[model samples]
Target chain A: MIFSSALIETAVNEFARMPGIGKKTALRLVLHLLKQEPAQVQQFSEAIARMRQQIRFCKLCHNVSDEEICSICASHSRNKTLVCVVENIRDVMAIENTQQYNGVYHVLGGIISPIDGIGPDQLNIHSLVERVQQQEISEVIMALSPTIEGDTTIYYLSKKLQGVPGNPVKITTIARGIAFGGELEYADEMTLARSITNRLPLENYMQK
Target chain B: MIFSSALIETAVNEFARMPGIGKKTALRLVLHLLKQEPAQVQQFSEAIARMRQQIRFCKLCHNVSDEEICSICASHSRNKTLVCVVENIRDVMAIENTQQYNGVYHVLGGIISPIDGIGPDQLNIHSLVERVQQQEISEVIMALSPTIEGDTTIYYLSKKLQGVPGNPVKITTIARGIAFGGELEYADEMTLARSITNRLPLENYMQK
Candidate 1:
């Protein structure tokens, strides 16, 4: 980790500040940049800076967007009545990549993690409740990760969504079970229990 | 790989351009940046760009430096006559970290590799030869990687240095043998063979 130049040291420190990147890996990244053309390096830096400075959140769902509202929120082809709630913007992309869901999304920004000091207030929960109350949303699907925090957020949101008198917005969570190609023997006890509890009909499993 | 924002897409692409970083990892890094404050993100971007633009290579040895001459080359305490020739600036740092040698260095920038379209001409071989000829250098230690390309570069550089009449610069290479703590049984055939061929004196081995 002994840097020959101050500039390289500074750059390596900046890279090391990121999650999962250590000092050695940061140095490798900086050295790689040294091999690239100045123009290319300049472009890379500009792109990162611009992304952080100019990137906007959707006014409707809190998803990342270039405009006031995200594309999914603005799209007419998607089912606006059925909203898929996720933990972050990355989850939105993951679900979108599946191309199976035709519903709009609401990004929670993060889950309710008490240990991490992140609670329901810090997330985009208020906006989501308001969004459901303002719009005639028929169903709200919780697509958060299968974790304790996810369950807590879903429970909190479900209670809030139902609290709105006469607005019986149907609440549902994404199915939890073993992965498609995963070995049954390797499955954790919790997952095995959930898989058995939520066992699908033979015909439905065959169709999938 | 679908991005919701153009800014995020550009930033992710920039990160993906780095060696060993894939599209998913790039997205993860970009999302981590998005979580940071604007000023912090701007500082990170600026540091990388500034390093690439402002960093200088030592005119004497081609190691990365802030000034025309690197610290090691400029230091009077280091032996000017004993030069350790390495493949790149990272090698110089690695050797420096050991704190074993008190000699200066000459960075080759790269090794001779035909498949990679790299040759002696592409490296700093000419400058290294000229340096040996002009200076009162007594010894030149080849501290390059133990690869075919490294051996080729060493062979080429040795020929060029000796070609200079009356210079008589004693040329040596870093030892190629089993690592100090490596198990004898697991040592590769090439390394074990080299260790046998260059068997050191008992006293010399004990002293080390």
Candidate 2:
């Protein structure tokens, strides 16, 4: 859309650079920022810049951190031997928010999407394989999304882990299909079929 | 959502403050930025800050501009004596994009709404009335949204303008009802009924 001012146009263009935001939405966001208090606007700008500038990735887990190693990697209470592998930091946050798994995470940065020109070489796969060999990791859980690329990454990682030469590390994937509290009838055909095949024993459910 | 880093959390919170953006969407946006190159992210942040710090409003029309007076107001070819009243700078851009009107614009900043605690004094209505008296303005076209507040603001401004001494400038509102390509069946009852009542003469339609 046409803006009366060049400054507004520039700001809007910057906002539209994001994945989902369009020109109209960008304009709305810029105008919203304009209405904010000057100090608040300053804080908004500085927060983004500071985060981009000062942000560090954990040397061990490859997760975002303020220090060399992230809190999850540093913490002794978490299960260091059972690392959950995810697509990105947001997935790490999602699993963390659930508070179900007390294990640490290994962020792959992204999946193996050949369509996007992202190969396994471009990911943190080498470091993951190294960590599996170096550390006495009992199990490596694949918590990536239920997509083709996710499956491919998991397959690639399992093969790599097997070739580590010493102790065999058990690699497993997160359960897929119908989500908790989801209606059986409302589920898609593939999910319903998968959930049925992957159903647990009735006694196992009672024990849990 | 739970974030391992406070910096990511802070940036996400700031993004969530924008209209229509939720915490999840904000997190997505922040993560997308984190994936970008440092220089591009720096440009994005600096653009917003600079725009907020240095952006100026037109002295004559209150439209967003980098100059003392807006480009439209400063243009010699445009009709300076005729002004189109609008709710905000976006509306000015919308009208200008059409290239149908040659007159200058007077931005009201916002429409008057008691529900939002916004009154006539909160808008730029006074300057518009003053402009009509000061300049050789022959007509003022009300181009606000077809809302209750827009109509209220128009009524308020007309009375306020009439209170001005000397030459009486004619006041008119942009035609409202069905759009040019809009279907009568799809239109709401109020708009469809209004369009039927305000039907122009056959000769006027043919001439136009």
Candidate 3:
């Protein structure tokens, strides 16, 4: 799109650099900012810049943190022995929002996708294994995406944890089945098959 | 959502404040920024802040510009006597992208929407009327949206311009009809009916 001012063009270009945003959406965002007070826009800009510049990754879990150790890792109430492995920081937030898991999180940064050239070595696998070995951790839950890559990552991590020179850390994965509120007829064949094969008793289902 | 860091939360909140963006999308955007280099993120932040701080509106047509007069208003090739009235700066860009019109534009900032509490006084209607009266403009094209509020704004402006104490300027509205790629069967009755009513002759269609 032809921008009347160079500043607007530059600002739109910056917004368009984001993954999902296009030129039109970028222009809309820029126009929205243009309509705001200069101080508010300045606050927004500073917030983003500060987040990027000062944000730290937790040494233990690799989740975004303001300090060396993330709040999840530092918390006294959370189960430090139980670690939930996720694909990214967003997953940690998603799982945290559910408030069902009281365990700390290990953000893998990304899943092991051979097509995208991301492998086990590129992730925070070494630190996770080190945490398992050094700490008195009882379980490591794989909470990655229910994809082929997620399975591959889980398999790889399980194998690595098995070789650690200590008591074997119990490895578990989040259940794979038809989601709650999902219609049985609408479910994919794979999910349908898995749900039937891993069917739980009524007592077990209701207790959870 | 529970955020580990306040900085990330603040940035995400800023992004979520934008129209059409929600908390999840805001988190995704903030995460994307976190993965970028510090200098790149700084540049993006600076561009937005600078655009908001330094951008100016054209003194004449009220289009966004680096100078007092917009490039369209200053251009020697564009038709000075033919003015196109639009709702916003994006509308100006949309028309400019078509490259069909050689006339300058007058941005109204917004249309007359009583429900939204926006009226002629809230818009740049007075400046537009003054421009029409003072300049030797031959024709004024009403290129506002095809909405009740748009028509109301057009009617209000036309009435104001008619009181101009000199030579009369011809007023015309942009043609309303079916979109080129839209299927006739799927079009609403009002649009289809209007398309039939305002149907152009073969020679006129071919020439344009």
- Judging by TM-score against the true structure, name the best candidate: 1
- TM per candidate, chain B: 0.93, 0.90, 0.93
- Report, for all candidates in order, the number of backbone clashes: 0, 0, 0
lDDT accuracy of residue A15 in candidate 1: 94
C-alpha lDDT values of all predictions: 0.91, 0.90, 0.92
Residue-level lDDT tens digits of model 3 in A48-119: 999999999998899999999999899999999998999988888889889888989888899899999998
Give per-model CA RMSD: 2.1, 2.4, 2.6
The parts of candidate 3 lying over 4 Å away from their true place are A185-201, B177-202
iRMSD of all candidate structures: 0.8, 0.9, 0.8
lDDT of 2 by residue, B1-208 (tens): 7788999999999999889999999998988999899899999999999899988889989998878887888889999988999999889988888888899999999999999999999999889988988899999999988899989999999999888899888999998679878988899999888888899999977975
Q: Considering only N, C-alpha and C atoms within 3 Å, which residue pairs clash in candidate 3?
A: none
**After superposition, which runs of candidate 1 have C-alpha atoms over 4 Å from their true positions?**
A188-203
- How do the candidates rank by lDDT, highest first? 3, 1, 2
In candidate 1 the C-alpha lDDT for residue B19 amounts to: 87
Interface RMSD of 2: 0.9
lDDT of 2 by residue, A78-127 (tens): 98899899988888888899888988889999999999999989999999
lDDT of 3 at A112: 90
lDDT of candidate 2 at residue B205, scale 0 to 100: 78
